[model samples]
Target: MHVATADQHTADWLMRFGLVRSEEHLNHYRRQGFAWMVARMFPNAGLEELCAFTDLNTLLFLLDDYLDHQESSASPENRDKKVKAMIDGFIRVLRQPKYGEQSGNPVFVALAELWQRMKKMSSRSWQRDFIQSIVAIFTAAIWQHENVKAGKWPLLADYMEQRQYLGAANIATDTIAVVDKIRLPRKMYEHPLLQELTALCRNTVCWANDLFSLSKEIAHGDYHNLVVLLSHEENISMEEAIVRACEIHDDQVKQFMRLCRYLPNEGPVMKMELHRYVEGLKNIMRANIDWSDYETSRYQYEYEEHVRTHKVREHYLMEAAV
Candidate 1:
């Protein structure tokens, strides 16, 4: 739960790139304290590691919001195209870490910087894995958009399967190795126990997020949430859905605890790395809950007021066009 001193510096860097435009935008970004969350998740990161990871997390928060807003507002035909372009841009920069240097898009520029820094310290195998996790996130985003456009409500099982990637939990977990420069043996990294633990960690954080952010998503006309889906699928009240969601989240936490208590012996160094990695995952779960409950104003936003303002802007634009 320790916060990095470099959190403000990361926010300032984002502001410099014109990401935080108005006072409202700045307030929105700062209130979430995304960098603070990053710091907690990687509590042992060195100053340089902390700064780089914080920058990545902060930029991602903005990118996720941008994609969600665009997908929700744009015509179905045009929506996928924009998200696909973003995915391609990310892949291109990942393939050639310097490719973003020539681009004018701020997203690409920031991504390239992150890629360059990450590539310097991480092995090629690690980089490839990280890229795969990121691509999975984009793919899941497109899937969510498709579901929304089709007015589809995914079954609870299906949503849980894809939610791990969509929540970007894999990407955040992968950073455990990157920030600490701890590379586990290939076999150890791929062990079933480790894989299960990772999934448990992802589910715990994401479901808790689904619970905390349910109100905000409902206000935004977004149903790609566990509580909403649970409510729809079970034909239950929102209160009942929330209780069910919490039960599921608690189950995951219990499993994570059970797995942590029985980790196999992978020799001393490998065992230590495994412990640290899982600990980082635990930290992320804790940080998410703490930040969502106390540090963020995101879920407390005046949704109706925002909708009214948006309508006013639309009408003003229509009048000007006429």
Candidate 2:
């Protein structure tokens, strides 16, 4: 299925950018089956769009992992410098893709190529939206780093507000139009209803992830999770925090569903595109939960051994066939 297609493609893509250096690294990256999630989130995507989405998703996950590692291990001053460098390099590539082609950093070079590819597939407006989301991601990283440096957990409200951007859900959702080949007018896309729906979608995805990753984050003493933040801020038990976080996530899901009922009946084309976009958001929420439950080993330890074994067998089989 989608995993089979994206495995080779993503491995090659990551290796080309020097992001992955070994069979073990490729196995670890592929074990998450991000392409499977992307395929689920954008069910309407054709082959090309699916591949592009897979690469984009993989790149985002890589960046998040690298930064998260830096958050824990690197000194505050060192991490800040590294993060700033990344933000600057990425901004440069965003402005001019060719600028990073000659750079030594694989991430910069990779992003330059990926940005160029994305530009060819999206409208100018869509490109702008995607870039804004990316900048939000960089901003969120700085926000999180500052909180960590200060050794304080943000209040629940503040964490929720910024957590959506940290999750990159906006970038994922923004691609619906590209996948569907429907360019929404800026006015329609920015309508209050749609904007609210987008917020709900982002919150739902990010909070659900917090729920799934609670144990791991707690073990790592990472305070960037909603559940952890709520527990610490409210002086509540972990169980109480979990229950409250679930309540918040369920509320957002319900709100998203309720608002979809009132989608504007613009022109036929606009209406249809809006519905398609809404469906993609629904798919994203659904896929996030489903993937966390069934596919991702990051949250599910039982699945890790299963995934590792399966990947090893698949690798050997492919080698044997060759």
- Residue lDDT tens for model 2, 1-322: 4556765787789988899768798789888888888888888777667777888888888888888888877677888899889888887888778888988889989888878878888888778778788899889888988888898768878888898888988887788789877667889888999999988888888887887777688788898988778888889987777777777777666667677789999988889888878877777877777777677677742223433233212222221221
Q: What Cα-based lDDT does every candidate model obtain?
A: 0.76, 0.78
Q: Write the per-residue lDDT of candidate 1 for residues 221-303, one digit (tens) a residue.
A: 88889888998999998777776777787767766777787788968887888878877777777777667656777666332
Q: Which model scores highest in TM-score? A: 2
Mark the regions of model 1 whose C-alpha exceeds 4 Å error after superposition.
1-4, 301-322
Error of 2 at 262 (Å): 0.9
* Candidate 2: stretches off by over 4 Å: 301-322
